[model samples]
Target: MENSIQSIPQNWYLILSSFMFCIGIMGVLFRRNAIIILMCIELMLNAVNLLLVSFSSYAGNAEGQVFVFFIMVVAAAEVAVGLALLVSIYRNIASTDINILSKMKW
Candidate 1:
C-alpha cells in the first residue's frame, strides 16, 4: 500500500508516452534535417521505453526494465553507426540535409 501510494498511475505514463511518440512521428515526417530526424527517432524510442517501464512497474515485473536496457544498448549502437554515416555524407556534400543526399548516386 505504501508503494502504491507514492507511485504514479499507469494511465498518466501511457498518455505522456503517446504524446511523446506523436511528437516524434511528426518531427520525422515534417523535418528535413538528417540530424533532427535521428533525434526524433531517438525520441520515439524513448517514448516506447517510458511506456515499457511504466508497464513493468505497474505489473511489478522486471522483464520490461531488462528489455529497456537492451533497447538502450541498441539505440546507442544505432546512434553511433548513424552518426558515422552522417559524418561521411557531410564530408562529401558539406550538408546534412536529407534532400541533398539523393545526389549521392555514383
Candidate 2:
C-alpha cells in the first residue's frame, strides 16, 4: 500500500502549483491594498517553489532544487525592497491605498 501510494505520478504537484498560482494572480489583480498584492506575489513564488522541489525530488535532479534556492534568494530580496517601498509610501501619504497613491506628489 505504501509503495502504491508513493507510485503516483508527479503531475498532481504541478496541478496544485498551477491552482495556487492562479489564485495568487487573481488576488493581485483584484485586491487594492499594496501589502495584499505583495503577499499574493509571494504566494505565487512559493507555489512555483513547491512545484520545483516536487519535480526535483521525483526526478532525482539537483538542478531544480538549485533553482529553488535562487528563487528563494530573489523572493527574500523582493520582500525587503517591497516592504521598504511600502514603508516610504506610508510615511509620505499615511495611507496604503493603491489608488490614492497615484494622486500624491513628492
Cα deviation at 54, candidate 2, in Å, is 1.6
* Per-residue lDDT of model 1, residues 1-106, tens digit only: 7787257677888999999999999999999999999999999999999999989888889999999999999999999999999999999899998887775677
Clash counts for the predictions, in order: 0, 0
Lowest summed lDDT across 10 adjacent residues in model 1 is found at 1-10
Q: lDDT per prediction?
A: 0.94, 0.92
Clashing pairs in 1: none
User: What is the C-alpha lDDT profile of model 2 across 15-55, one tens digit per residue?
Assistant: 99999999999999999999999999999999999999998
Candidate with maximal lDDT: 1
Best by TM-score: 1
| Inter-residue clash pairs, candidate 2 | none
**Segments in model 2 whose C-alpha atoms lie over 4 Å from true places:** 1-5, 103-106
Displacement of residue 42 (Cα, Å) in model 2 is 0.3
* TM-scores of the models, in the order given: 0.89, 0.87
TM-score result, candidate 2: 0.87
